[model samples]
Target: MLPVKPFRQRTGYCGPASLKMVLDYFGIRKTEKELAVLSGATKKQGVQDGEGLVKAARSLGLKAALKDKATLADIRKYIKQEIPVIVNWFSVNEGHYSVVVDIDKENLYIKDPEWGYTRAMRLDTFMEVWFSIRGNVPSSKEDFNIRRLIAVEPHKPRRGRAKKK
Candidate 1:
C-alpha cells in the first residue's frame, strides 16, 4: 500500500486536503489552512481548478504535473511507482477530488477525502465516473470534460544534513 495520509476536507477544502495527503507522504508537514492560502482557496470558494492545485504543490518545492485526458494506464503506472495520484472525478452526482493509491488487476483503491476512507471500485466503474462529463460544462452528474490528473512527485532528500559530532 502507498504511504498516503488520509485527510477529511473542511467544508470546501477538498483540494487542499488532497494535496495535504500527498505532501504528508513526502514527509512534508503542512496544514490544510496553509495549503488553502497557497492554492488561492477561500472559505466560500475553494480551489477553482487544477491549476490552483498545481500552483500549491509547486509552492512547496514539489513537482506537480497536470495531465489532460489521462488514461487508466497513466494512473496504473504511477501507482506502480508508489506514487499516489490526485484525480478529479464525479462521485454520487457531485464533483470531487480523491487520491488513487493502489490498483490491482480488477479494482482501484481510492483514498477519498470526503469519505475519509479508502474505497475500492472496479476499473470499469472508475473509468465511467472519471470520464462522464458533459461537453465543457460541469454539473452534478457530469463534472467537467477535461478529466484532469495531478501527480505530485517528491524530490530526493539531501543525505548530508546530519553529521556525526
Candidate 2:
C-alpha cells in the first residue's frame, strides 16, 4: 500500500485534494492550490470531470488517463500495479473524488479528502458509491458511465529525499 497523505479539502476542493494524494504517491509534488487551478476546480462547480486532472498530470511529466465505466476489478488491477487511482463517487447528494490506495478480497482502502483520513470500504459499498452517479451527470458527453476514474502511471522516485513512510 502507498503512504499517500490525505488532505482535508477546503470547501469544494475534493477533486484537487484527491489528485494531490495520488500525485504524492507517484512522487510528484504539487500543492492542492496548484492542482485546483490546473484542474479548473472552483468552489461553485468543483471539478466537473477528470480531463483536467489528466492534463495536470501530463503537464507534471506523469502519464494520466480519464476512464469511464470502470469496475471493482479495474480498481484492484491498478492497486496491484501499485498505482493509486482517483475515483468519483456519490455522497451527500453530490459527486466527490477520492483516492483508492489499496484493496483486498473484501475491502478497498480509500483516502477520502473530505474525511481527511484513510478507511476501508466494503466492496458492496464501493460498488454502490462508485456507480451511483447515474442521473446526476453534469453534461451529456460525461454521461457515458458514472464510474469515472483517473489512472496515473507511477514513475521512479525523484533523486532527492525519499518519501517518509
Candidate 3:
C-alpha cells in the first residue's frame, strides 16, 4: 500500500485536500490554499469537478489527466502502479472528492479527505456508490461509470537518452 497522508477537508475544500494528499505522497509539497486557487475552488462551491484538480497538478509540473466513465479496473491499475487516483463520489446529491490508495481482493482502501482517514470499502459497495451518482442504476459492473477521475504523476525523464552535462 502507498503511504498517503490524509487531511480533513475544510468545508467545501475536499477537492483541494484530496489533491494535497496525492501530491504529498509523491513527495511534492503544496498548500491547500495554493491548490484551491489553481483548482478554481470557491468558498461556496469548492471545486465543481476533477478538471480543476487536473489543472492544479499540471500547474505543479506534474502530468495529470481527467477522465470520465472510469471503471474499477482502471482504479486498480493505477493503484498497482503506486499512483493515487482522485475520484468524485456522489451521495444524496452531495459530491465529494477522495483518493484511492490501495485495492485488495475484496476491498478498496480509500484516503478520504472528508474524514481524514483511510476507509475500506468492499469492491461491490464501491461500485454501488459510484452508481449512486445522480441516482444512476447499473445493470452490471460493466455498466458502472464514475463521474470523474483525476490521475496525476510526477514527470519522468525520457528513458531513451541521457541529458548532456
TM-scores of all candidate predictions against the true structure: 0.84, 0.85, 0.83
* Ordered list by TM-score, greatest first: 2, 1, 3
lDDT of 1 by residue, 65-132 (tens): 99878988999888877788998787665456789988888998888888888889899888878743
**Model 3 ranges off by over 4 Å:** 131-147, 157-165
CA lDDT of each candidate?
Answer: 0.78, 0.79, 0.79
Worst 10 residues of 3 by lDDT: 156-165
Q: Write the per-residue lDDT of candidate 3 for residues 93-135, one digit (tens) a residue.
A: 5677889988888998889987999999888877767632322
**Which candidate comes out best when scored by lDDT?**
2
Local distance difference test, candidate 1? 0.78
Superior candidate under lDDT, 2 versus 3: 2
